[model samples]
Target: MGTTVLEEVVRNYRGQPEKLIAALLALQRHYGYLPEPALRVISQELRVPLSKIYGVATFYAQFRLQPRGKHTVCVCLGTACHVRGSEQIFHQLRRELGIEAGETTTDGRFTLEVVSCVGACSMAPIMMIDEDLHGRLDADKALALLTQYRD
Candidate 1:
């Protein structure tokens, strides 16, 4: 992890403390995850402490300390969705994506996440691609849905 991306991102923010989050986000986007080397680079570039950087990274659900895929698939595990077969949907996605929950595909094309709820119980067994919702999903439907993003 060189300092190039971190340095450029911090430079764009003019070293403002308020831009720390944004800078981290940009850095993460560039590198996929905030590795220790990158975090050290960021800390030095922004003149912020390593502890603070780690704190921010760990505090946010959106931040990942490990690599992630290009597209993230979130399946709802809320009571209603579970009752409606969200588990089967999750299993289908795992099989198709070839990765378990919280893991990214070997090709780095997709990541699977299981959330407690997506707040679309009426459309039980809902799954999300990025932020778009697909409701009333099952194994076949989920497989078809994922094919659209495979490329």
Candidate 2:
């Protein structure tokens, strides 16, 4: 049987057991998240158990089982943010994106998430899009932020 591209990724590791993380990262780089078939191929190619692969993937916050949207929107709901009406901002985002917390839009354009604190309370009511932290926002401004990301 021919090795799949996923198995080819595992082979790139050259069978070094210590390269498991590297191998998984390579796979994720190719396909947004760790696809199920790739995981199985990795297990077979590296002689590593599928359970261990899942364990490692889940242990790292950087790894994701589900595909992420082009944009990741995280709203901070810390006390400072909440006091500044972060809840309203979050709701506005949900309405604008048509996606509830932790859900990606059907078109895979955006993902909405809520975080208790992002250590940016000084900014208060912050919404982070990808790596950009947007603070001191009103509901309208927050909704407006989505415009630049729209197609």
Candidate 3:
């Protein structure tokens, strides 16, 4: 809605080409998603081409061109996790978040994603809250884990 953060970030960008990624990261941190208007503003402020900006955004997994949720829930769907009931975990999260894979919640509180593996096979059926991994999840355990973040 406002342009203060965007302007401030553009002002801090050095002339170096490498600063492009840093600038995008700052924008994402401020806005949660890279809106088209914001992208245009960034291009104008930095004097960088729009194509370059789009390229940088596309290159990075962290930069979301679309909206993202406040909390990201990543469930591992690796072989071990699958055998240990990760599908059930995925279902539970989808039902609780009210959004399918790669979607943010209506309230913008949570985003659900399924990853191929999280490397916690011993504790299969793991879900990560941001970077913190919770392992050995059953339906009840998963539900309880989600409750901790609910308003």
lDDT (CA) per prediction: 0.86, 0.87, 0.86
Candidate 2 positional error at 149, Å: 0.8
Q: Which candidate leads in TM-score?
A: 2
User: If scored against the real structure, what TM-score would every candidate get?
Assistant: 0.82, 0.86, 0.85
Root-mean-square deviation of every model: 3.2, 2.8, 2.7
Residue pairs in candidate 2 whose N, alpha carbon or C atoms collide under 3 angstroms: none
Q: Which ten residues in a row have the lowest lDDT in candidate 1?
A: 10-19
lDDT of 3 by residue, 1-151 (tens): 7659877787788454567778888888888888889888778777789899998899878889989877789999999999999999899888877889999888988888999989889999899987778998887898898888776
Find the 10 residues in a row with the least total lDDT in model 2.
10-19
Clashing pairs for predicted structure model 3, backbone only: none
Ranking, lDDT, top scorer first: 2, 1, 3
Task: Output the number of the lDDT-best candidate.
Answer: 2
lDDT of 1 by residue, 65-116 (tens): 8788889999999999999999999988888778899999989899899999
Answer with 1 or 3, whichever has the higher TM-score: 3
Model 2 misplaced regions, further than 4 Å: 1-8
Backbone clashes (count) for model 1: 0
Provide backbone clash counts, one per model.
0, 0, 0
